[model samples]
Target: MRTTDVVRAAGGCVVRVGAAGLEVLLLHRVSPDEWRLPKGRVRPGEEPETAALREVREEAGVLAEILCPLDETEHQFTDRADSQRRTKRTIYFLMRPLSSTTAPTDPDFDQAVWLSPAEALARLTFDTERHVVGVALRLLLGQD
Candidate 1:
């Protein structure tokens, strides 16, 4: 693997209980094919924990309280032109919604929806993201 830079990001699976058992919140975008949790780059002098919650509220419009840390996933991606190589490790967490409202004041995603963990697993676009969600789900289920 080529080492260009390491990026710090934080986000997590926001979960709630529904008739289906447990559901996770996911943000959707079509242009780049994204269907996963809200996450973003950690600003300078920012903690990953704080960044994760801020990104979640900014992208998903819901106020959530963190339950615990899920796991961190490292993924590498190259720009379409293959000019930039970067690796990002996102720290995922398990959170519970404190309120229900689409606050998307930042408008980073096209749409946001809550889906069962199984549905989220199938709809997620990246394997690493799926793994993160799976870990969070099992933690939520006491199976982890």
Candidate 2:
């Protein structure tokens, strides 16, 4: 029997803090319409934190300041091909927008919105990502 191992990739979570409290930036996938944080695969020769920041800008058209250390999550799921098991390693960092004027760009996200922590938690589709969001929320609110 041949054993196969899939490569894992890194990602980031872009968040914003404001007077209304901490709000997470969420994007709706074009196909599924599932809401999620702006994230993408870390490119070759890219630092995880840098990739996080780049992904946020590319996916959401937002430039933000990374405020804290990175948090990560790992899980096994079917690959995009849906024919093999793959582990996704997502590394996240808390970020604050430099300015309030920002919106997601083309191809990455169809729509973008800011949501309260509770609403974000409720709207997110993945459990692990949601947990990451929770951690980011706590960090942003100084609850952790």
Candidate 3:
């Protein structure tokens, strides 16, 4: 696959259940009024699952383990860095936090915070992302 023309990324609904219900980790963009799950471009020769795990760590400073495959969202857009038209396919996984320590480390986002699943679902900028989070929630409830 020519990565230049088609970019691949991976991310997921990293969650923790609490008294308030399920909470998902979301990263707020530095300038844009948008919040999204941790994600980044997949490196050459890197697996999507590996990329997902790395993105969570690098972007949110959250260590998590994938519970299952959730879904994939694909969209074509122009790359801001080079103005090249490209298609990005992002695969989402249902992940659970492995530890309580977390922080936002990536410079791309201003902050990362946990939000209630309902609020998070509503705050997602894209419908596809909201759907992915729903998928993860369904999977979690099903297993309970």
Q: Which candidate achieves the best lDDT against the true structure?
A: 3
lDDT agreement with native, every candidate: 0.83, 0.74, 0.87
Which residue ranges in model 1 land beyond 4 Å of their true spot? 1-4, 79-83
The order by descending lDDT is 3, 1, 2
- Per-residue lDDT over 1-144 for candidate 1, one digit per residue giving the tens place of the 0 to 100 score: 544477789996899998878888989965677787889888989999899999888888888888988889888767455657788888988889998766566654778888988899999998888988888877767795
| Clash totals in order | 1, 0, 0
Clash pairs, candidate 2, are none
Lowest-scoring 10 consecutive residues by lDDT in candidate 2?
A: 1-10
Question: Against the true structure, whose TM-score is highest?
Answer: 3
On lDDT, the stronger of 1 and 3 is 3
> At residue 117, what lDDT does model 2 achieve?
83
- Give TM-scores for every candidate, taking all chains together and pairing residue i with residue i: 0.88, 0.83, 0.92
Off by over 4 Å in 3: 1-4
Q: Write the per-residue lDDT of candidate 2 for residues 36-119, one digit (tens) a residue.
A: 777766776888788778877877778877877557877777767657877667777877777576677757478777888888
